[model samples]
Target: MNLENKYYINNSDLKITLEELKDKGIIYIENIQRGFSKYPNLIIEGSEEYVNNAVKQLVAANGIENSYADFYYGRLDEDEKNKVKEALNEREIVIVESLQLSKDDIFVHLNDELLEILLKLTSKEVLFSTFYFTKYPTLVWGNYGRRYPVFFKDEFVMETVKEQIWV
Candidate 1:
């Protein structure tokens, strides 16, 4: 989804939402996507050592220095994939630089493992497997119900692939 095209309703209170996500095992560096991308993907912030290791592995895989400094969904070679997988096995954290987020700009994808916890902030009456923040600033489930799909504009799902940076 083009975040620029769709209307975004900033949430009145994001503190509660941030706290809730913390309770769900989602680690993020708020307001850390401004220079990289318009949408903020859930980035992993870690210590210098870990971030450096992650960068080295990513550069080896993509053959692009500093590419791991931002959020991207690019094809990785098998060797590169293995290296990233190995790093994740150690449970390292990664982050993006110059990305900043306010509570109002935050949104989570429905498929996120932490979605169940996020839904607690929304209505109990609406049973939505898929979710997104709408113009109302209320959590809405279902893609057809909103202008953009959940995690459409600002989203990143870092599975086993660990692209990271120092905070």
Candidate 2:
């Protein structure tokens, strides 16, 4: 049985009750961050029977808007590349880390972390972007006018930055 159940929460103010759902047998949980708090979407994928039961329990406790019928399933495939060659080709290493105003301190910490990662990840000298979101300390990827922000969510750290890096 394909287990892909989609659900939406209208008022995202209520903290997500992950433990309760996990106890009911949730195999995986993916948060769809649309850069908006009002229409937050979460994908809970697992056994069809178990996910449905878990959703019922979640709705009972949180009263979150449930759209169980509309679920999206995605597969992630990693692209293997030679980092040294990419660097030799003058591809500016784009290190992105998602950030929030409340956790600006976290930004400072992760920025330092990204710098360390870049130092190890690339052979070329690292340069910081001064134009976009200077406070976050962006890195230029390729050449002139190709400056990439270190705290972006699109290219490199899309998966790790949201929950792991910054927080």
Candidate 3:
């Protein structure tokens, strides 16, 4: 079997199910993020008759659409949207807990947890883009001219923001 990176297909040419992929030679199966993604893709890694499997490719999903902001969130199905909402709603930090507040409280820097959330939104392209960090407090967005609202510390952040995601 000289096949490389080909899916574990049966004699009927239909790709084997996830359950079968493991039993018969297939070692890895996952959706890989490609370019400016729009949806899912299944890539099957090298395999043998249960013992000859070679770890050729490490499969991973895009996780969430973030770089293009305002749009990627909408592109996600209901389940992904819910997960994102949950992440944003988590409140384990205060401006004092992880962020430094300005003299008058008008401006606050990014919290570690929030910064992590923003980083994950960006596309994991071959060459990672630095916009995720450069555009401090705004999060990742593809729109060149759209003015993103500044995130304030004393607002109903988790409750109102997550709810407004649809609006």
Candidate 4:
């Protein structure tokens, strides 16, 4: 892992739908054809160690950092997939239309096809997963999700999500 890369933890309430549900089922896209890129940042040596220590300090503060965060999907059996699927279907959209997209904005397309992609995320080191559907605020998931943001539909799966962070 590149320690120099920035890491953050969010503690604010999110109002967006799933695609980030602080926003909804999102693809975090840009105009790929235009070669839009992420903002450059200072990469100090040994930053990961520093960030880890800082993260530890943050965790020491109650309700500041959610050290124990997990999604509600684990609670549902077959219904888990269905819940996500239903959210996608209801938030159905295609970006082909004449939607004016900002250069810095992430372009997300929600639909039934997203169900399969959402289930394939398994990397423990993943920056973001479908866990955004859980009860915690969007900031909790963005702790790592910001690096590689993924979103799902809004409201469609709020019933299965917890609004607070765990532990």
Candidate 5:
């Protein structure tokens, strides 16, 4: 999808987010758009080697089985994909999203360090498919009776009251 003119995030905000993520043991590099387009997509790039190292570090930190990294490149060839898959197979937990990558798409394991880092960067908790709702939700479910008005009318108070009343 063309991300032009879309409000994915501001540069400063993204920097802050990345800083926080790094503090939580995640590393990322910013890929600024070089062309003339006014609205450019901010791409987060990292090498497979770097990601592997991060996964190992995370496994050690969390004291749990290795997990997978949440991010992936949408345009990787077969050789690159296999290399990534091999690395992921050696881990314990895998976090991946279905994207058009190569002929054979494989899953990888991830550790808590990477997961926590991703959560911080995205400002949202993430989890496996089994815990999808608890991790992310497209819609919120709630119970409301007729006594609780779904549609209501309220009076608008535009004037500011300066007097302070003591009870």
Candidate 6:
């Protein structure tokens, strides 16, 4: 199944959870960062057993700091990666969502890899537009304009700074 969904979490809360995970030896922050940077909108879908096991591992390593289970890269380490991967492998399906950006009438760049995946999911009838902007001598940027026609049900989208790019 395709897991494409969006969530908004306070940055401070995310940071606290990361810190707690690190303290309990559940995950290495660096690994988590790498994963998030590489795959922002990742939908980790697993059976009840898989989810329970993964959560157990996470809790045993470190108790939950926040009530949410949103994983952050800066809080995961090598061992955590392996555990998460193992849990993912045992699951029946995993769907990753590609994030589409929009800002005050402007669209940001979409990573090529994400674009290819989106193309496969969308039909030819879908049209995409992008807008470019220049701000004095400071900088110039562009955005993907709007959301694509495709939809993701359970995926997680990480919202970052407007000027940042996730690839």
Instruction: Provide the overall lDDT of each model, using Cα atoms, as 2-decimal numbers.
Output: 0.28, 0.25, 0.25, 0.27, 0.26, 0.25
Candidate 2 residue lDDT tens string, 68-136: 111000111123224232442222222221211121121122233233333333212232211111111
Provide the lDDT at 138 for model 6.
10
- The predicted structure with the larger lDDT, 1 or 6, is 1
Worst 10 residues of 5 by lDDT: 158-167
> What does candidate 1's lDDT look like per residue over 4-108, in tens digits?
224333322222344554444332343323413443333323443443243334333333211111111123345643543343312111111011223242433
Q: In angstroms, how far off is 64's CA in candidate 2?
A: 37
Residue 94 local lDDT, model 5: 31
* Model 6 lDDT tens row, 37-128: 44332332344344233223322222233112222222345574354344332221122212211121122222323223222222121222
lDDT of 2 at 76: 11
lDDT of 4: 0.27
Name the lDDT value of residue 46 in candidate 4. Answer: 26
* Superposition TM-score, candidate 4 onto the true structure: 0.20
- TM-score, cand. 6: 0.18
Off by over 4 Å in 1: 1-37, 65-160, 163-167
Clashes of 6: 15
Give the Å error, residue 8, model 3: 51
lDDT of 5 by residue, 15-119 (tens): 122233334432222221221132211221244343324323434433333222334333455575454555442221232222332332222233343444333
The clash tally of candidate 2 reads 2
TM-score of model number 5: 0.21
Backbone atom clashes (below 3 Å) for every candidate: 10, 2, 0, 25, 11, 15
lDDT score for residue 81 of model 5: 47
Clashing pairs in 3: none
Estimate the TM-score of every prediction: 0.21, 0.17, 0.19, 0.20, 0.21, 0.18
C-alpha RMSD between model 6 and the true structure = 20.3
